[model samples]
Target: MKTIQRIKNVILLLAIITLTISCNSDDNGGTIIDPEPTTISKYVVGFQAFPVGQASPAEYILDLPSLESLTTGEISVEGQGIPLRGWRFFHSAGNTVFTAGYSDDDKCIAYQLDENGALTEKANFAFQSTLDNYAALDDDTLLAVELTYGGLSDKRFHFINAKTGLLEKIVEHPIDIDMGSGTVEDPGSIPWVTGMILRDNKLFVSYHKWLADGSYITPDVDRAYVAIFQYPEMELEKIIEDDRTSPIGVNGHSTGIEKTENGDIYSFSTSALSAGFTAASKPSGILRINNGATEFDTNYFFNVEEATNGGKLFWMDYVGNGKAIARIIVDDNIGAWGVFKEQGEFFKLVVIDLINKEIKDVSGIPIHANRYTSPMFVEDGKVYLSARTGPAIGNNGENADLGETHVYIVDTETATATKGAKVLGLALKGVFKISN
Candidate 1:
């Protein structure tokens, strides 16, 4: 049986696949379908596999589509049965792996991997006895922001020595504001640290500034900048402020900030604020700001109206020649395009024309009606999407709960979507390009 992680949250992640193909479709109006090309290269998918109810943690490095075979390793280094909640593969000068997770005890733990891709007991850290948000600054340095409890605030950021597992530098600022009379405090509102990215020698962090009354405040348009710093020293250099859009409020959270080759930065968040509301109550949107600007581009907001809650952009990338293709996984929207309400409730992989800012709807492609899927584009113009054979529910519901998901690869050059492979008990997560 396939091992699955029991995430207490509303949703849990599983697997991802990608292939190579064309960019156009045929007269029949579907992704071009050709035989699974032989030009494919094997990309490694490192995942955490655990059963639904058990705490026995095992790590997996699997070649997707071949569910039967797996290179199994145990995450039993420092502590036995550490629950892996999240994983990210970073860019390195040499080969290195940095993974962060919560322990079975609910404390934060960051683990390192050896050159051979095995989890190492060499570098490890227990984060302040709280659930902390962390990202790799690089191979040697790491950024860790603490999660607050009982309406209390913590540090804004910390720089840790990835090699020595020691705190190098720290940034902590306290904010005091009333939580309106009669409102209780929620510790979950702790500035949920989203993602961290590096450009030039500067570090950019996407974080929500938490408010005192148990709620959070989106950064002011002037303050809605990537919290900037320099490397190694982790000094507060300055903020990459933008003047592109007016001051709009976010729910004070965003996924990882994405950067293009042209040095443009992009970020998305699920918020509950109106464009005209105060900094604490505006709706959520995907915001884009060019480099060095202090304003949120009013034009860059993709409003998921009325729903203050939704899954985040788990992955984003530039596809197509000359950066024409853009794919983003909005785990809450479930692959629907346009300003539709139902679109924001499920997981979705949106294919957008970045230059034109147009996302292709299911009607524009060959996907079944309401058959939501997350897609990844690999080399040679290939796009891959995965869907469960039955209903659109993501959890393990009745009706083929195990191994019902299907993967389809679309060759945009040929404009065809074809069923490429099947996996038992697998749900598609994010995709990474392994080759040029």
Candidate 2:
């Protein structure tokens, strides 16, 4: 009887151990066992290598503890960071980091933090054309616009599933091109998208008219145009125009239209030659479209050039509380393409109050120049921007003498800039925080 009782006890103990192991481990080979929840936070920084000897620049993504601190004198991707092929554009939504290849590749890859706190590829998808404008409708949906240039055709809008990295749907619409004076034989102007925003089931796209023949000439430079479309359906409702300012937004940089907290939409017009415009027909300014309205507000007009006494707006991002941080061009001699080619210190950081129409210059940051800068990151009323000083290009077609790149932390309320970590790359494409 004692031997039988001992055998039963041993069998019960073995069964308990087996049950514990089965609960903790994946029973099926295809099942993925999730790691324990972690409270640690990680930041992902995208860096672009200098295209000196290579045919195209390579992008690297590195996970860091903080963007403001660096253990070394300057952080580089020499033997670290996940290297990506070709020139890429980086954007983050929720916990995923997205890198869209440009010029060299037509793929967009989405990365997420794994159980080991490393950036692991989650999804890879391809697109026909480069995504020029993007907006996050929600955490799961990303709307990207592709402008079909070279001829009159239908512009494509892609609705992508952000989490699954799949193309959900594509909406094509032929946005009416305003060809002033020139006909089909000799096209005068083509619509160049500057910014896109979706608010209250309405989509607003701001664009400028430019010749598609590579001259970069603006045929209709005296009016600001925004095409309003219905959400989900993407049907064009109307094309609103404002004569108070020149074409809204600049080439390459998407800072044209910004929606405030209260739903008021403000469009910035860059009529400056420094912003890649062949001519300046109207003063660089700001126009407003009131909340719940699809037309421009006739009572609202902010003359940025007059307010700053001839300062041309280069790039801007809204912080919070009706305030935005803008990089203003201070030197008039930068020429038409000087912002891209001859970059002798010209950009000045300033805080503009959208509600009161006031401009206050930020202190502690010297004049700097940047080319093809990614969108600024705003968090907790502090705006983080990559500021680069010195020449934009060298005599040998290299990125020589292109001064050090530093992360500038700008305070929205105090209007002050505090320099942060030094980046050892051509420039920082983006800085993002992903929860781990």
Go through the candidates in order and give each one's C-alpha lDDT.
0.40, 0.78
Q: List the residue pairs that clash in candidate 2.
A: none
Model 1, span 195-274: residue lDDT tens: 56677776666655444453334334333445666754567666544433222222211234656566666664433122
Off by over 4 Å in 2: 1-36, 54-56, 67-73, 178-185, 341-343, 397-399
> Residue 65, candidate 2: how far off, in angstroms?
2.0
TM-score for each prediction?
0.54, 0.86
Candidate 2's error at 384, in angstroms?
Answer: 1.2
lDDT of 2 by residue, 22-135 (tens): 776756633566787876668787887665563555789888867555323576888889999887778766777788877677988888887778778888888988877776
